[model samples]
Target: MEKLNVNPNRMELAELKSKLAVAKQGHELLKGKQDELVHRFVDMVRESKDLRARLTEQFSDLYQQFALVGAELSPDFLEEAFLSSGNSANITGSEASIMGVRVPQFDFLLPKDEISYPYSFSYTNSELDASLRKCHRMMQDIIHLAELEKSCELLANEIEKIRRRVNALEFMTIPQLQESIRYIQMRLDENERGNLVRLIKVKNKIKK
Candidate 1:
């Protein structure tokens, strides 16, 4: 708790009173913002959970398809096939600010060439090619969802920090300041009453 120095003059007391009012108002606004951020963070967590479940199911299906293709196709061969298909990705990242916190923005660019997967091997049939294509598409979606989940986590952490600060000001600092202001006011009033009594005594002496 912080204590304000008691001023002899009423001018300083008036200024302190005004400052106390402003601090109270700021505390209320910050508390409201904190509540809103918490609500938004909860929603993001729910969304991230759902996205993760979907991504897991899609990935499992893709792995089963790969297994059916047989071990004859080397991992390197599959990678090369995917690469040779002219499927290249461009990932652009930017920064977005929320309540003075910077969160990441992810942009995915898939050119027309990236959409087609071509196979060079004679054993590769249309079913295999179609499965590979679907897997590639799912991979892109997974990347996008991962970025979204990460951004949400980062934002939630920042919002929590802000909430703590707001709570400190609202529940602790502002109340302490108001208490100090009241103490100062009471002390000043006492001093004024004493001075008035002394002045009256001196005036009576002069009259005698």
Candidate 2:
């Protein structure tokens, strides 16, 4: 702790005390915010982990099913079927506030006939149908995972910033202010004692 560069007087002492009070209050508030942010960050990390695991499993299954379908079907037919698909997807972007951090939100939109297969069932194998259906169904999950990952990144950055500020107040600014206050108080007390001694000397001289 270092004393601030201020005159050792009552006025400086009062100012330092006031600053110390404000600093402490700020530290508490920042600490609370940091705790809340960390709690939310941990929850998001778990959610992101679970979501990624699920997506990885689903993707593996989808790839196997698609491989089987490709092996049995002609490339030209597969390309035509996929090209004829009327399904289209869109994402809408928005913002959400969490603990003063603005994170992104996404809405994955699909057509009403998204589940409708463009290719005739008589021409396509059942595996192909299943693969296509699963692909369309998992689109929303993919978007959700992206949103969660991005939110986690943003929250992590915010939490780091708040942590630094809290540390500064707790370890540096508050201690310096307190030390300055103590120094000024000691000086004032010593000055008061000296004044009292001088008054006693004056009274004795007058009495003689």
Model 2 residue runs over 4 Å out of place are none
Q: What is the RMSD, in Å, between candidate 2 and the native fold over all Cα?
A: 1.3
For all candidates in order, the CA lDDT equals 0.73, 0.91
Which stretches in model 1 have alpha-carbon errors above 4 Å? 71-83, 196-208
How well is each residue in 114-175 modelled by candidate 1, as lDDT tens digits?
A: 45656664856565675767776776667667776776788777777777888887778777
Clashes of 1: 0
Task: Assess candidate 1 and give its TM-score to the true structure.
Answer: 0.80
Cand. 1 Cα-lDDT:
0.73
RMSD of each: 3.1, 1.3
